[model samples]
Target: MKNNLLLGITGSIAASKTEKLYNSLKDQYNIKFVSTSEGLKYLDDNFKINNNIISSWDNETGSPHIELSRWADKFVIYPATANFISKLNNGISDDILSATALMYKDSIYIAPAMHEEMYINEVTQENILELSKKHIFCGPKYGKLDIGDEGLGRLLEPDELINIIEKTKEKIIVTSGPTFENIDLVRGITNSSSGKQGRAIAYELLSKGYDVIYIHSDLINPVPHARNITYSSSDDLYQSILKNIKDVKKIYMTSAVSDFIPEKFNKKMSRESGELFLKLSPNIDIIKTIKSQYKDIKVIGFSAQLDDNLNFEKINTKNCDYLVINNLKDNYFGSDNNKIFIIDRDKLIYESSVENKNIIAQHIVKNTTS
Candidate 1:
C-alpha cells in the first residue's frame, strides 16, 4: 500500500510551488491536499484534485479535520507562513490545518517560507525553535525569493523536501572546496577546485536519506540541505572536522587542502618590492589524523593526480576505506563532467567514464554502501 501523505498548504508566496511539489511526488505516495483559507487564494485554480482537497472544516462528514489527521501516515506543511507557524506554536486550533496538527501525533514536517526579515524575527525564531522539538524542520534556505530579494527564507525545492521527509538517521561528514593558506593580507595559496563534485556528493547522500554534516570553504558553491560548518585555512578545516565528528559513521574528505603554508604570515600587504622569499611548512594530514582516532569510521579520500593510471601501491590508504582518483589531465577542476577510478586498499574496484558530477556522486554512494 502507498503511504498516505497529507500535504497542508499555508499562506505564503511559495504556496504556488505546491503544484510542482505535488506533481513530483504524486506517483510515489497516495497524496491528499488541504489549504488554509488564505493559502487557497495563492494556489493555482487549475491544480489537479486527487482524493480530497479541504479548505474549511465545515462538512457533512463528522469532523473531517480529525478524520484526515488519523488517515495520514505523514503530515507535511510546505511553504509554511509566519502566521501559520505562530498559530501552530500557540496551540491555535480554529482552522482545519492547525486542528489537524494538534490532533496528529506521528511525523509532521514543516518547510518554512517568508521574507528574510520576517523569518529572522525573534518571535518567529522562538516559535520555530519550539516547533522543531517535535516536527522535522526542512529549510528556509538561502536563495532568490519571491520579491527579487536574496537571503535566507526561500522555500526548499520539492525534491529537497522529499529527501528531508524520507531521510535516515545515519550521520555522514563531507568536507569540500579548497582550503586557503594566507601568505599576506591580500594573497593566499589555494587550489583550482570549485567544490562542485563535493556539493554534488552531499546532495546525493541527502537524496538517499542520509544525514550529512557539510564542512566547506566560504568560496565554494553552496549546498542547501545539510548542516554547514565554514572553514578558511587548512588548520580551520582540520579543527572543524575534529570538533564535529563525534558520532559520524562515514567521512568524505573531498577538500583540496593546501599541502604547504607560509611559515610566517605578514599581518599587512608587503610594501618592500625586493625579491621576496617564503619558508613553507607542511600542514597536518587530515585524513590520517581522523582515521588514527576513529578507526571504525568509513573514510573516503580524493586524489587529484597528474597521471592517468593510479599506482595503488604508492598511494597511502591511512585506514581510508575508499579512494577516488581523478587525473588533472582530464581537466575536472571546475568542470561538470568527471572521470574517476574508485580504488580500495587491495585493488582497483570501479573505473567510471566521464559523466555528470551528479551521476558520479550517485555511483560513489552506491559503490561505497554496497
Candidate 2:
C-alpha cells in the first residue's frame, strides 16, 4: 500500500520550507498538508491554501481529526513550536494540528524550530523529554536559524525529514553497535566499538534497496534513521538476532558481540572500591546458529582482531558464509577508512587495503549478490 503522510505545520518562520518538503515527498507517498493558525500566517498566498489543506479537530460531523488519523500511515510535524510541543506533552489540544497529533493512531515524528534559548529552556527540555518517550523529534540541528543568532534550534534539512519518513516501515531489521555485558548496574564489559561501522553498513544496505531493522547497542549519536531495537548484553543481542533471523534474508553480524558475559548480574550494585569477582561465560554464537539453522539465509560475521593473529582460512570455513576481517591495530572500529579482507569459502576473494566503509559495503553487497 502507498504510504500516507500527514504533514502538520505550526508557527515557525521555517514553515515556509513546507513546500520543499511537500514536493520532495509528493511523488513518493500520499500526502495531506495541515497548517496551524500561526503557521498559515507564514505561508505565502501564492501557494494553495484551503481548509482541505488544513486540519481541524473539533468539527463534529466527520470528525476531521479522527478521519485524518485513520487516513494517515504516519504523522510528521515540522516547525513544531515550543508551545505546541508543551501542549502535546500535557495532552492539550488548543489547535487542530496539535489535536490531530494527540489523537493520531500511527507513528508520529516532529521537528522543532525555535530560538536557541527557548530550545534550551528547562520547560522545553522537559517537554522534549516527554515527546521523545512517545514520538521521534528529529532535530533542531545546528544550522543557520530563522533568527540571526544561528546556534541550534533550526529545522532539520528537507532531505533528512523525508528520510525519516521513508525509514519508518515495519519491515527490515538492522543490528548495529557493540553489546556490553554488564557486571553490575554501574560497571560493565564493552568492546572498542564506536558503532559507526555497523551503522554505516546498515544505512548503506538500506540505500542499496534493503529494509533495515537496527538492534542498537551503544547508539553514540543520532541513531541511524532506521527502525531500532536497543540491546545491551550479548544475551539480549543473541535473542534479538534469533528473533529477526527468520524474517531477514541477510544477517550482518557487524556488532562487536561480546565473546564473554558476566555469569551473574546485580541490579543494585556499586563501584565503591570493592573487589568483586566476575565469572565469564561464552556468549551464544549468533552467526553460526543462523548459518546452521537457517541454511537458506546469508550470515556475515565480522572478525575484529588487534593483529593478524586469526586464521582467515579456518574462520572462512566456519558456519558463516562470509567474514569481513578487520585489523583493530589500525583503529578499525571508529575510523572512517578501513582495510578489510573478505573471506569466502576459505579464500580471500576480495581485499581492501584502506577504503571507506561505505565503499567496502557496496563491494560486499555486489559480491553477495553475484
Candidate 3:
C-alpha cells in the first residue's frame, strides 16, 4: 500500500526545489502539497503544485488543516524556513501549514533550509533540539547556501528526501543481553552475554527505517532511535515481549535467558550463618511458548552452545522460523565480535567468519530477510 505523505513547504529560498521533489515522490506516495503563503512565491507559475496546493484552513471539503493532519502517515516539511521552525516550536498556527504541523500526531520529517547564520542562531538551534524529541530530521547538508554563501543550512537533494520518506516501515522486536534469575535478595544468576549483537541488529533495523522495540538488559545502553524496554529476568523478558507482541512482524530472541532458575529467597542469604543449598528448576521456554501461541508470527531463536555441531532438534522443537547458533568456546560470551551459523529447519543457510558484531548483524539481517 502507498504511504499517505503530507509535504508541508514553507518560506525559504530553497522552496523552489520542491518542484523536482514533487515529481520524484508523486508515484511512491499518496501526497498532498501544502505550502505556507510565502513558500508559493518561490514556485514557478506553471508548477504542478499551483493547482494542487492546499494553503487555506477551509476549502470546499471542509477544514483541510484537520483533515491533512490526520490523513498523513508521515508529515515532511521540505525546505522548512527559520520562521516556520520558530512558529512550530512556539505553537503559533496563524497559517494552514503551521496549524497542521501543530496538530500532527505522528513523527514528522523536518528538512530545514536557510542561511548559515539563521540555521546556527541559538534560537533556531534550540527549537530544532526541542522538536527532536518527537520528530525526525533529514538534512540541511553542508553545501551552497542561497546568497552565494556556503556553510550549513543547504537543503538535501530531492532524491535524498524521497529516499528517506518513501522507505517501507514495519515494527520489529529485538531481545538482547542476559536475562537474570534471582536466587536471593542479594544474589542472582546471569550469563556473560554482552548484548552487542542484539544492539547491533536493532541499530541496523533502525537505520533501515524499521520501528524497532529493543527489549534489552541495562548491561547495554539503548539504541538512540529505537523504543527501548529493559528486562531483568526471564519473566521480565517474557512479559516485555508479550506487551509488545501485537503488530510486530518479527522477533529476534538474542538474549541469554537462564536455563535453570534458582528458588527465590525472600531475604538475602548470609555466608557466615550457614552452608547454602540452591535448588534449580527449569525456566520458561519462551521461544517455544510464543511460537506455539502465535504460529503466524516469525520468531528467530538464538542458541549459545559449547560446540559447532549442527543441532536441528532444537530448531524443530522450538518451531522457530530461523535459528542462530553462537559458539561459546570461541569466547563470544562477553565479546564485541561473533561468528554465527544461520539455519532454517534442517539446512545451514549462512555461516560467517569471526567478525565484528555489527558486520555480523548486517549479514544476519540480510540473509534472514532474504
Q: Give the number of the best model, judged by TM-score.
A: 1
Candidate 3 vs. true structure, TM-score: 0.64
- The C-alpha RMSD of each candidate to the native structure, in angstroms, is 7.6, 7.0, 8.1
What would you estimate as the lDDT of candidate 1?
0.82
Report how far off residue 307 is in candidate 1 (Å).
Answer: 2.0
As for candidate 1, its clashing pairs are none
lDDT measured at residue 197 in model 2 versus the true structure, 0 to 100: 70
Tell me the tens digit of each residue's lDDT in model 1 across 1-370.
7999999999898988998988888887898887888888887766734435687867536897888899999899988999988998899988888898889888588888998799878788778767766777777765678769865577888988887787566899999999988888778888888897888788677655677788999897445446778999999999999899898999999999898988655576556876778889888778888889898899999898897676565346456888998887885699978989998988888899988786788788888875
What is the lDDT for 16 in model 1?
Answer: 87
- If the candidates were sorted by their lDDT against the true structure, best first, what order would they fall in? 3, 1, 2
Candidate 2, lDDT over the whole model: 0.72
Show pairs that collide, candidate 3: none
* Residue range 142-257, candidate 2, lDDT tens digits: 44676477645778778876666565432445567788777776678887688767766665554433556678784453333345677888778878877765567777777888
- Candidate 1 stretches with Cα past 4 Å from truth are 1-5, 9-32, 35-50, 56-74, 77-167, 314-317
Q: Would you list the rank order by TM-score, best first? A: 1, 3, 2
What is candidate 3's lDDT per residue for 261-348, written digit by digit as tens? Answer: 8999999888787888899999879999999889988888998999987779999998999999989889467786789999999899
After TM-score superposition, what is the CA distance of residue 115 in candidate 1 from its true location, in Å?
22
CA lDDT, candidate 2, residue 122: 79
Residue 220 of model 1, lDDT score? 70
